[model samples]
Target: MQDPNTLCRRAVEYLEEYRDSQRHLRADGVGRSVGDVWKPPPNSIFKLNFDATVFVEAKRTRFGAIIRNDKGAVMAAMSTGGPPMSSSEEAELLAGRKAVEFATDVGFSELVIEGDNRNVMKALSSSLDDRSLLGNVVDDVRHLVYGMHWINFSCIRRGGNRVAHALVQHARNISEDVFWLEDSPPPALNALYQDSLLL
Candidate 1:
């Protein structure tokens, strides 16, 4: 057996190494991207990218959400359908809320919530009371944020959110909600691979 003192020293060294890696990740920006590429979150933090598409012919909205770790590995992904939305912005807002709920359901507390819709992201990051038609949904998201230990809201270009977009497209064919834990469906796997190339 190893000496007790040696084991203690090794444990402390491992912890220091982990702390340094976390610092490095934070310094690099949690989820900030370079141009229009998807970026991973900092160590121990997950990034949830969400999107929504309006199926006007079906009179419904499809929401897609994908949660990935710092290594760009999908931890959880979901493609779900919702009631018809009058506007795209409203659909985006609802998708954001559903994404948050999905993350929490999967037991993630530290998250960087990302979306391609600027208007929805702006409303989510704002402290001012939203009095628009979708204000209630925005409030629901804010309430969910309070339950998280750490959370950040970010707006990225559509290119950076291709996986989620693909999932939304996949939702068009499925009749029921679909979820993948620690994995992604075929539609999103290609985009996931493309995004990881930059990582």
Candidate 2:
């Protein structure tokens, strides 16, 4: 198994590769759209944007989640590390679960859980049972959703998930899970501010 330091280094490298790919896609105008900007949730509701990075070679995964009020102000944020994942889809499913867990722990009931993984979001919002390899994780998230007063699953482009992405990337340097209440971490502050600009 790779040491934590080595895993962190790999995480940073993977993040850079992902960013490069996104840049190339944008330059090709393949995924650019007006809706790429993050939007605030409705009044009395909170938006939780979550993202995850899988270091398959390192047998590890990292996920970050941010909760914001209708004004787009950060209410809480978290960066957490987890065990190995076989696929990005599994990683995303786990991320969504972690995000929901974080939000509920922070006392949020009305929520819009957003992520960049279209397939995961679709499965999450669907009423049908999931039987894939990641079905258990999906079921876990759905069960959490049932406990909420109101909840919605939304899929947005990666560009719109910058703040959460930044948080996941920032997880590289930490040895343990980190949580911020009523504040945004320094690495995500700029992205958080940029998101508020669109509100």
Candidate 3:
């Protein structure tokens, strides 16, 4: 017969392996579910998806935002290039700031702001005081949020924010910031078309 200690050890090992497999299965499921697609906000609300791209060589960061209504029709779009940033997270924070300023300028009171950077989104969405490197940016974004009649900040999978990503890429080729009413840059048109289909 096997010794009791040996049997207990074997049981523990088997249980650990089982638990690990279960964890992996759950992770895999989540991974498979992240097929990013743009989603509209509720009626009377505008959804704004934003993204930022940092150009190390140019020493600048580009931001892009797209605002759409519940019907998924594009309301407006913006692409801006700004000063250099140290990290992508910081760039993302700037994008959030830009989105808020753009919406506010456009007289939009109700909006949902989304981005692909989870860390930046979490900082902006939560009330927790930012004590890290992005503290100042977080503070500014909070100030913007408070000015809005109603605003929701959220993080989305990169796949879901492709159009914003594409817009920033387009911004890199332009000299100045630009906004669109019902049109988009030619390079970003394909991504805009794809997002429309998802809606």
Candidate 4:
């Protein structure tokens, strides 16, 4: 359908049914549910840009995100991670959910998700339901995003997600204890990239 709302709504419903077949974490253990946040007040506006770094060597996933206003200056930037699952799709969804959690944790009440994973973006816009071949990871992501705002998933290319992309590149090569900035590599990432040192 040309109507994005109707499409997203159907996908949400399919996701809910998928979640129903899965186990729920005890209420306290599930980090913050997306329900705690406020929906856009009818037509309110906000945007969240997100991306994930998947490392083949360590099988890790690191997500980076930024919240921006209409003018596009960033209001928030964050990074989070967990072990990677079987498919790139799972990594993408995990990144999306954690980014949303970070936004709500800091009181963002209205937002849409932006990411480079076309797979998850397409799934969020369609009613088709099947394991992402990623299993519970998909359900966990769906559960985390059950409510809050006119949350639409927009597909972007990696180059368009520069800030978050940079973070993921760093996460893949840098040690956990280090941080870097502004085109300057962390000493650790620098060394690893050179193949002169073991990370």
lDDT of every model, 2 decimals: 0.91, 0.87, 0.84, 0.58
TM-score for each candidate, following the candidate numbering? 0.82, 0.82, 0.79, 0.58
Clashing pairs in 3: 36-160
TM-score of 3: 0.79
Which residue runs does candidate 1 get wrong by more than 4 Å? 1-33
lDDT per residue as tens, model 4, 80-154: 566766667777777777777777766676677777788876765454564656545556555555666556667
Q: What is the per-residue lDDT of model 1 for residues 1-199, given as tens digits with 9 covering 90 to 100?
A: 9999999999999999998976665553346557468889999999999999999988889999999999998899999998898899989999999999999999999999999999999999999999988899999999988989999999999988999999999998889999999876788887886786567
Any idea what lDDT model 3 has?
A: 0.84
lDDT of 1: 0.91
Superposed Cα RMSD, model 4: 20.7
Query: Candidate 2 or 4, higher TM-score?
Result: 2
User: All predictions: root-mean-square deviation over Cα?
Assistant: 8.8, 14.4, 14.5, 20.7
- Report backbone clashes per prediction: 0, 0, 1, 0
Writing each residue's lDDT as its tens digit, candidate 2 over 110-192 gives 99999999999999999999998888888998888888999988999998999999998888667899999997688898787
Error of 3 at 16 (Å): 55
